[model samples]
Target chain A: MLKNLLLNRNLTCLFFILIISSFEKIHAQNAQVINFNSLQKIYSNKSDTTYFIHFFASWCLPCLNELPDFVSFSDQHKNEKVKMIFVSLDMKKDSIKTLPQLIEKFKINVPVFLLDETNADKWINMVDKKWSGSIPATLILNNEKKYKKFFSESMSLQTLNKLVK
Target chain B: MIKNIFDFSLLVAICVLSLGFSIKGNKSSYDFHLKNVGGNFVSLKDYPSAKGFIIVFTCNHCPFAKLYPERLNGLNSKYKNLGVPLIAICSSDTITYAEDSFLKMIEKAKNENFNFPYLCDGEQLAAKNFGAQKTPHAFILWKEKNNWTIKYSGAIDDNGAEPDKVQHHYVSDAVDELLKSKKVSIPETKSIGCQIHFRK
Candidate 1:
């Protein structure tokens, strides 16, 4: 009886370790880096997934304030066909320190990218002529249908849901 | 009694009208005194050699402002020599974003190789004075016989993205017109940039 009990405990420990290892692997896969060029391809591939691109800066208060809402929205609809991407508008220098913390803190499961280009005006205009170079901006794209909308303010979960639909 | 009531009502009406006028007159101009990146008090009157002044509502973190740092530096280099000193005031609230702090402003200026004065608007008084709504808002003033008159108020340029695509260089054009003793051709334009983050 003593031998059987010890064997049971060992098996339980082995099970827990396996579960933990699987979790770590999943997290590592989730944290994979998605660069901008790949994102462009994703948007152009006519995939069924809806892309939600958020333009944010480390120093933008409004962007930080609205981040939690986006996280919750992403979580609630994780099973859906929606994919989220955070694009950091922080200067290339600050991105090295700030972007990773933001992704980790928010537990952002989707891809996150940093805008590496200089001369914001040129790139901003190229991204969307109506952008007006504002932070806390969002671009919702239905890549399958090639439909897009630009939101210049904070978003609510209800609004995000509606956009996804 | 009826005559007296009429006189009282007329007096109240005149008082209201005069108050409106006073408010309108007060909207003409106001003073802003704020600390610079070095923690020294900087005011409009500090530039004794300036005929007038240029106040630009800018911040260290806005990508829009970052894009035009060199342009603004060049503006300061040229305009200061021509008697118009430039002052960049950061009106973004620093309470939430520590990066916009006065110390960070100094670091940003040094990193960007700034040549002009960058002032910290602790309470956004300068932004309120000019009704600046966004980062990179420009207000140019000209002294007309010792009275500082606002010559131009608007965006720095029509094209903020590519320097080459700009159809109109509003600030430079206004300054040139001021130097030529002529009124600004375009007195105002819509400002496009990051919204000024005001503290709640």
Candidate 2:
């Protein structure tokens, strides 16, 4: 009986270890590092999905201030055809730990990605030749990849709604 | 066939993406008369001796701006004698971010032991005229017959987060070329930094 109990406890510990690691893996995969070209393909492809991509950084105060509104907006429109992505332009170094913390801090369920690019000159113009490389910028795209708009500053839920429509 | 199709689609997507907005670039530099941290007014035209100006839109609370204090100090002390003094601007709305108030700016200047004036853009006059969107956004201006013409505008260097690891020197090289009476080689560069907290 004693031996059986000990084996059961060991199995339970192994099970938890597996679950925790898999959870971490899923979360890691969710925040997959992407560049401008890769992301252009995903949102600009031809389907019926509306793409709302918001650029933010952990260090940006304005980005932090208006994030909850964006998150709640996304939550409220969960069933809609709109797909929201929160792109964290945070430096690639600390984002592994910091991104998770910020997500947990706000209890955000929206998918967040880290824009993994170093050469700003090449990629900045690619996104929108006119983007002055400002944070809290946003991009909304339609299925045909024709109806697209870029906001170069912090926006509210009302602004977000109007853009989606 | 796939290559042609891919290229054609990308062109269409880019045309659609870049339709509405025009990215701000080189233009005539704007003149300003704003108060420094010391409560005195200063204007760009006052520096008659300077061959040009390094008007950098910066503030106290920005991490990117904070990293450049030593660099700014060096730029001023080294080039002030060369007739290219650096003028830093804080365009952040003080009402929204109390840490960026004039009082704190003075404290920050004192703590940093600044050699140059750090002015407060009380009304965001300079920021708007120059179309400056980010803190630590640098513009290298060279004087023409009378007016100062903007020659280069963008980041200070290739890297804003790390200094020692920087490979390209954008502002310094431009300044050096201007001092030598030669046209700047690479006119512009870009980097990530804090957006200016302008009030709606």
Candidate 3:
């Protein structure tokens, strides 16, 4: 009886560990890191892929609230040659703590990036003149050749679908 | 001589009428006010000693605003003494996000040691008047003769994320030009920051 109880406890521990490990693995598969240089290269090389760049900050409640829609949209359209990039506008200091947690919590299925540029104005203009440095802003590009549209509001999947299509 | 005088008066009347029309059109920028962090009311008229007022629509929760807290503080400190008083307004809806409430605003101001008066636009009337769509939106008001005019409106600097990378300091440069009795070259630029949270 004693031996059986000990064996049962050991099995339960193993089961919990396996569940946690699988969860971690699944999360790791969902999020990929992309830097500015990598992004430029991807856009230049894969001209067929539609790029959706999202400007967000961890501190922004609207951005946080809208993240799930973005993740679901990315998952639903994985085979459509569409790519989603989450560009966090979080300060450089908060990147390590906030960025990964946000990516995990939102179950983001896309490349995540931190805007490492120092000057806010220069980078903002570089992205688009109409951006106005607003969080939860999205820039949709068609095949890296066309400037599709820019939205300075929380996005819905319907809107994303329309833009991509 | 009487006919010449009458003609000159007619020309002056036409010019005056056109100027009045333009000022009325531009009244939107001047028609707003915000409650200061101290819960005291303040408006463009409150700064009687100022040649102009720098109205910055900013918030505590925006990373962009957090990044430039010191730069803004410095601008306020330097310019306030020189006759251009800075007024920082928070138009974000604090009812939903409790972190942006008036209390948090006080904490942010105290923690940042802000030299300027941080104001709260509780009803967002001021934001609506200016059509402010984003946090960190700026409007530089200049007093011309007795009327207040908008000299510059938009981003504070060319650098959004990195202060060190700034190519142009729009607010400071405009104030400097105004001090020199010259016109601001760039009157407007695109503003970037968190979207102003309007209450439903």
Candidate 4:
């Protein structure tokens, strides 16, 4: 009986270890590192799904303040056709740690990506001619509706909802 | 393929046109007499011997701006004797961010041992006049025919986080070229930084 109990405890520990490792793998897979070309594809996606891509960095204070709103908005609109995507503009060197921590801290369930690009001068214009490479910028696009817009400042939950509708 | 090429050219034309418009738009006013941290107003006119100015829109609260105090000190120490002096301005709304208050700016300047004048744009007139979009945004103004003409604008350098690893010293290179009576090679470049809190 004592031997059986010990074996059972060991098996339970192994099962938990497997579960935790798998969770880590899933978390790692969710946060993709993308480039400027991939970003253009997302905005220019010819689909019915409305894409709301928010650009932010970990060091930007205002971006940090408004991140929870985006998270909550995504949570409330999970059943809708609108898809919320979070993109981190954090430096590529720290991206591996920054993005995953951001996902965990915010409990973000939607797709998350890191924009792995240097030279903001080149890509800022491609993203939006009006964007001055400031953090907390957002892009909303829907090919079916033929609607596309960009905001270069912090946004509120109410504003996000209104813009999507 | 021909149609795609035509469309690409059209897009490029529009981009160039818009870029021209923006470059011209920010040159409305180049003179400012804003209060410095030493409780006195300072302006380009004060530095009559100055051939140009390195005006950086910066503040106490921004993390990005915080990275550049030492860099700014270095730039000033290098260029001040060469007829170009560095001047930093805090044009962020004091109401929104109390950390950017003039008192705090003075404290920050003193603590950082600023080698140049740190001005407070209390009413944001200088920022609006200069069309400053974000903190740590740099502009190199060259005196042309007795008028301050904007010669270079944008990031101080390519890498803000790691100064030692910087490949492109945009501001310094432009200043050097201007000093040598040559046109700036790369006049403008974009930088990632905190947006200046403009009051609505």
TM-scores for chain B, listed for all candidates: 0.82, 0.83, 0.81, 0.86
> Which residue pairs collide, candidate 2?
A130-B23
Candidate 4 docking class = acceptable
Give TM per candidate.
Answer: 0.63, 0.78, 0.76, 0.78
The C-alpha stretches of model 1 lying farther than 4 A from their native spots are: A1-49, A126-130, A143-148, B21-52, B59-78, B97-125, B128-195
Tell me each candidate's RMSD, in Å, in order. 8.8, 14.3, 7.3, 12.8
DockQ for every model, please: 0.15, 0.33, 0.46, 0.41
The CAPRI class of candidate 1 is incorrect
lDDT of 2 by residue, B88-197 (tens): 99998888778889999999999999888999997886898887888889998888888788899998877666778777778999999888889999887666778776
Top candidate when judged by lDDT against the true structure: 4
Q: Model 4, range A57-77, lDDT digits (tens) per residue? A: 887778989999999999988
Judged by DockQ, which candidate is best? 3
Better of 3 and 4 by TM-score: 4
Score candidate 1 by lDDT. Answer: 0.77
Error (Å) of candidate 1 at residue A56 is 1.0
Clashes of each: 2, 1, 16, 0
| lDDT for each residue of candidate 3 in A70-97, tens digit (9 for 90 to 100) | 8889898888888887887666676766
